[model samples]
Target: MPTKPTREQWLRHVLSSATLTDAIKVTATELFLEMRANLHVSVPRALLARRLGRSERQVSRRIQVLKESGFLDVIETGWKGRTAVYVGMFKSRGSDAQRVTVSSTLCEAPKRHPLEKPVPVVAGHRVTPWASRHITIGHLRHGVCRNVSTDADASMLEHVPSLDGHAWRSRTAARLTFSARSAWPLLRDTHARLAAHLHLRLRPVAAHHSTAARKRTTP
Candidate 1:
C-alpha cells in the first residue's frame, strides 16, 4: 500500500499554490495534521475560528475554498448538534510524478498584477494622488507630513509615530485594493489617522532644514 503524505509534505504543496493565502494554508494544514490516520477531521467551525482569530463565517468560507480546490472533501456538514467531518485528499509525496504535478500546477497559477500600477482606480476617473499610477514608499511617507514641497525634503514636522514603514505601506495598499470604488475616501481617512498627534519632530536639527525653506518668488 502507498504511504500517505506527511502534514509537512502536504503543506509545501499548498503553500506553493497561489489559490490560498498564508493564513488559510496554515489553518487547512493544521486541520489535516490534527486528524487521525483515517483522514477524518471532526472539528467545529467555532473552535477553528477562535483558534485562528477569525469569524466563524470566515472559517467556513476558507473551508469552502479548500473544498473547491480539491484538497478537502466534506464527508458530512455540521448542522444542529453536530460537528463537520472532512477528509484530506492531499496525495502522497516522495515520488517524481508528484513533484512534476505540483510544479506544473504552481506554474499555471494566475499571475497577480504588480501593485505599482493603478489597479485600484476605477474607470473614467480623473487621476489624483490616490488614483496615481504608482504609489511609492515616498508617497506614503509624504502623506504623513502636512507641508507641501517641490523636492523630496522634510519641510514639515514628522507627524507619524515610529513604526515599521514598509508594513504600514503594505497595509495601506491592501486596504485600498479592496475598496476600489472608494479609494480616495479610504486613502484620505488612512492618511488623516496615520498623521494624527502632529506635535513630534524626532529627527536631528539638520534634517529640519527644509522646514526653513521659503517659496521662491520672481524678481
Candidate 2:
C-alpha cells in the first residue's frame, strides 16, 4: 500500500493552491498547526484566533472562505456551551472516486485576476486611484504647479481654470464659503500668478543669455 500523506504534506498542498488569499492561508496554517499539535482535526475558531493574534470575527471570516473553497468542512456546528468541530478536506481520500472529484474541483477553482487583488492598506486607511486623482486635480485647481512635469499636466492647469461659469461657480461654492462673484476673480488671479511663475521658472537660462547677446550685437 502507498504511504499515507502526512498532515504537513496536506498543508503544503492547500497552501500552494492559488484560490486562497494571504489572510485565509495564514488562518489555514494556524488551524493545521493546531491539528498537528493536538493530533486531531477539530480546531476551534476561538483557539485559532488566539493563536493567529487576530480577532474571532476575522478568524471566522477566513474559516468561512476556506470552507467555501472546499479546503475545510464543518464536522459539527458549535452551539451554546459547545465548540464546533472542523475537518480539513483532501487530507486522505478513502477511495479513487473521492480523490478524483476533489482534485478536479480544486483544480477548477476560479483564479483571481491581478487587478482584482486587494491593495495594501496604509496607516489603517486605503488610498484608491480615484482619491489620488481627485487630490491631484485639487492641487492643480489651487495654484500649486510644482508637480506639473509634463505638457499634459501644464495643459490641465489651463483647462481647469477655463471651466464653464456654472461648473466653476458650483465647484467654487462647494470648496469655499465665498460667493461665486468673489471666488471667480480670486481663482482667475491665482491662475494668472501660477502661469507667470511657470513661465519664469521654465524659461531656459541659455535663452536669456542668447537674448542678451543678441541685444548687445544689435547695439
Q: Point to the candidate with the largest lDDT.
A: 1
Tens-place lDDT digits, model 1, residues 121-216: 565523234343333335455555333432333343344443443455456546545656646665666555544422132233324544555323
Clashing pairs in 2: none
Q: Quickly count the clashes in candidate 2.
A: 0
In TM-score terms, which candidate is top?
Answer: 1
TM, every model = 0.38, 0.38
TM-score of 1: 0.38
Worst 10 residues of 1 by lDDT: 94-103
Q: How much does candidate 2 score in TM-score?
A: 0.38
Off by over 4 Å in 2: 36-40, 91-219
lDDT of 2 by residue, 159-182 (tens): 335443345545544543343664
Clashes of 1: 0
lDDT of each: 0.59, 0.58
RMSD of every prediction? 26.7, 22.0
Q: Which whole-number lDDT from 0 to 100 does residue 10 have in model 1?
A: 58
